[model samples]
Target: MSLNVLITGGAGYVGSHVVKTLEKSGYFTVVYDNLSTGRADWIPDAELVVGDIGDQAALSRVFKRYSFDAVIHLAARVSAPESIKKPLRYYADNLCGSIALLKQSRKHQIPCFIHASSAAVYGNPGVAPVGENAPLLPINPYGASKMMAERAIMDISGSSDMRWTILRYFNVAGADVKTCVGQRPENPVHLIPKACRAAGLGQDISIFGDDYDTIDGSCVRDYIHVKDLAHIHLLALEYLAGKNPSIVLNCGLGRGSSVKEVLNTAQRVSGKNFTVNRKPRRPGDAPVLVADNALLKKTLNWTPRYQNVSEIIETSWICHQRLTGRRSKN
Candidate 1:
């Protein structure tokens, strides 16, 4: 028999991808989202519950209704610059809202949890190829919020019959192979999608900083294709159901991409050259952040397929045009 999974924020980018992946593997999913950032059009198959995670009453109703085998929590605010300006909102939405979900999980004895975390929690590790064992010193409120949520998950798992996997994602980019379901236009802060939008529109792309201590003097990030990232989440969910191991892993390609390199790749993939402008560095921007996925490979035996940048950009470009309704190019 297939297990039932509760996926919060299932109508969002990565959450929707996970829902599609899980359904292919024969898992029934129930999506709980308030539609704040998630779009209803994303989850075309699953049953969606329109409610907030902070609404404890709603969570209680859902928990009583469904026999959930796992809870994949993906609902949270995800922006560093915005978090810095509104730390309280980050805590309330990301951290406090997580606590409410954990309470429900514990109340209903949900067996597994796969949390969607971010590499921002590592915040300028001051080391290349940062490992899971590396110190977590988040410099921004968004990172701090993720860290606090992780802590809550751990605290609840230790005392309850719950197994958890926290997947700290690097720069997740690209879209699904088809133009059917990809990121929405309102996605504010992802690098590749924004770049794709610029390339598709024939607008200038902004490289935040050009003086970083990297090969191209631009900020470096470990870009993992969104499809690969979603698979890791599926693997984590399966591992938790079968083995029930508490694991924390970094999801990435164990390499770095400079901002300028990404822009050039975007232009090449789209067959369109957009202007590039370098401005002063954005505050709280890290010079370099790459992942060391040794633990991820050993623990989950996962391998990435989209190791090249052009392929990711190609898919992203298609999705960007689709997102913008194939607008007439300038």
Candidate 2:
């Protein structure tokens, strides 16, 4: 029998891609999501259970019904700026919900657990291309909640037979290479999706800050393509199945792109130009965050295919237009 995997928040952008990849790889997937930011259509082929991760009763029912060999936890609030405004919500969803999931996983005796962490945990690191060993000094409540979640996973796994893999992702952007699964434009919180939407509709794109201590005075990030990030999750699952020890990996391209640079790339790729509105730096904004992906390469023996910013933006632009009922410019 094929191994059954329980994917929390599997209908979201990254989770949907992972579900497709795993399904293609012959794994049976069951998606559990709250439908807050995820859509049911995103995972058409897999079984989807509409529920929140914090609801132990709901999780208990699913665990009893499905014999899950592993659990991939991805459900949580992900907006940094919004987290600052509503910190308690972030804590409740990201931190407490994660602990609840961990409890259920332990009770159910799930052997493998993969967590979706963020580079925000290493907020404003003193070094460029931050590594897995860097100190986690989160600047925002979102990051803090993710950090706490990581700690909880470690604490739980230390006392049990559950092996865990924590993937600390940088700015995950772009669409699937096949353009089937991409980010939705409704209330986009990320920069690339927002930029793609503005370019599609001929509107102004907002630049959060232009006075940061970096190239072009704008914050720098290491935007990894969503497909590439999804591929790594598959690799992590395979590694775990091999009875490998618990590990943490940073997911990125090992380089940085300024916000202005990405805006220019989006315009060029979409064949559209729009005005950039500069605003004061938002709180919880990091100055620069680039991942040191050397460890990931060595561990997973994997390389990202969509390394160019323009290529990534092109796929995103195409998917954005398709979803928004707009024609892509030639």
Candidate 3:
């Protein structure tokens, strides 16, 4: 019998890619999205259900209708600045919704659970390459919500029959190389996609805080290709299916790229000389955050294929141009 996977927030940027990957890998996939930030058109071939994770009635119905062997929970309100402005909203969506989903999953006896966590969980650590064992000092409500959800899963794992893997992502970028899906947030705040859009329109892009302590005096982050991240999810699912131990993995290449560096690469890839305006740093902004993905490689035997910076930028630029109908300068 084939495995059935239920992906919350499956119509969103990263989740959509995971759905497409699962479909290609011959798994029966079902996507549950509220269309709040996700596009309905993204999940065409898979079983798509429009619903909220917080809605117990909706979740219960979906669980009852399908025999999901595993659950990949991605539904959440993921905006650091916005989460600061509306903390209650973040808690409700990120924390409460996850609890509700886990409750429903337990009720249905689903064995595997995979969560999409963020690097914001390690807020402004003095350390360079953060590891899984690093201190989790989240500075914002968005991070707080994800941390809370991770704790909930850990606690549930001790007693419940559910096994889980939590992947803490750092600066997920790039698009599906196959062009099957791409990032389409309602109001995208991610650097690469937003920069691509600005370059496409010949608009001035803002570089938030160029005075941070780094090689270029700008905030540095590790950007991981979305396709690579999706592949990690598939590996985690297979690992869990084999009754492997519950684990937490930091997903990223163990390298740092500054904001100015990203902007330069975007301009080069898009062939557009877009202007950049330096601005004050937003609240809860970290000076630098890079991952130490040694554990992920050692444990899972996983190697990231898209390791080149230019390749990531080019793939993202192509997808942005395709969506916006504005080709980048050659």
Candidate 4:
């Protein structure tokens, strides 16, 4: 029998990709989003409910209406800087909202729950290739909120009947190779998307910090293609189907790329020399955050396809061009 999947925030960048992948895999998919950062047009085929996760009444209605076998919780406040400025709002939206979602899922008796966690949970780790057991010293409120929610989910996992998978993703980049869906947030902050937009608009881009102890004197991050991350989620669901306990996995390529390297790749791919200015590093900015994907690969036998820097930049650049209708140099 096919599974009935409810994807919260399914109209957003990563969630929308997961929705499409699940639909293509023949799952009956339903999208629940408030359209705060998500677009209605992105989720084309799925049944979308424009609602907030914090609203328990609306959540009850949706769960009661659909017999969901699994729930992929992707809706959360994801800005690091904004989270610092509005810590209470981040906790309310990311932590409180997730608590509400978990309670509702328990009431609905969903079998499997997948959460979208972040690599920021490990703030400025002194070691490379950080793992699930790495010390979770989140540097900012956004990461703290996610860690809190993850703890809540784990606590409920034993009492509730639902199994869960907490995937701590690194810098998610690239786009759907088919270009069916791409990163199109109303106010973009991610490095790749922001750079793409700047290149498209012929505007100068800025690197937050340049004195970091990386190879290029800039902060380093592990970039995972969105499609690859979606595939990991599917694999995680399948893994949890036979297990009783909740699982935690880091979703990344286990490789690091410096900020300057990414910008250079974008310039090379687009053949446009967009001006870049180095600025003071923002507060809570980590020098390096790379994932130790050994568990992800060993546990699920998953391998990333779009692990190349050029491929990541090219796909992102193409998607940006398609949306803005501007020709990048190349």
Query: How does each model score on lDDT?
Result: 0.87, 0.91, 0.88, 0.87
Candidate 3 runs further than 4 Å off? 185-187, 326-330
TM-score of every candidate relative to the true structure: 0.96, 0.97, 0.96, 0.96
* Top of the candidates by lDDT: 2
Q: Give the TM-score of candidate 2.
A: 0.97
Determine the backbone clash count of candidate 3: 0
- lDDT per residue, candidate 4, 138-236, as tens digits? 999989999999999988877878889899989998987576474772245798887787777778889999998889899999999999998987788
Per-residue lDDT value at 241 in model 2: 88
Clashes of 4: 0
What is the per-residue lDDT of model 3 for residues 79-178, given as tens digits with 9 covering 90 to 100? 8989889999999999999999999988888899999999999999888899999999999999999999999988877778899999999988898755
Question: Which scores better on TM-score, 2 or 3?
Answer: 2
For model 2, residues 250-304, the per-residue Cα lDDT tens digits are 9999999999999998888888899999999999999999999998999999899
Local error of candidate 2 at residue 31 (angstroms): 0.5
* Residue range with the least summed lDDT across 10 consecutive positions in model 4: 321-330
Arrange candidates, best lDDT first.
Answer: 2, 3, 1, 4
Best candidate (score: TM-score):
2
What candidate 2 gets wrong by more than 4 Å, as runs, is 177-179, 326-330
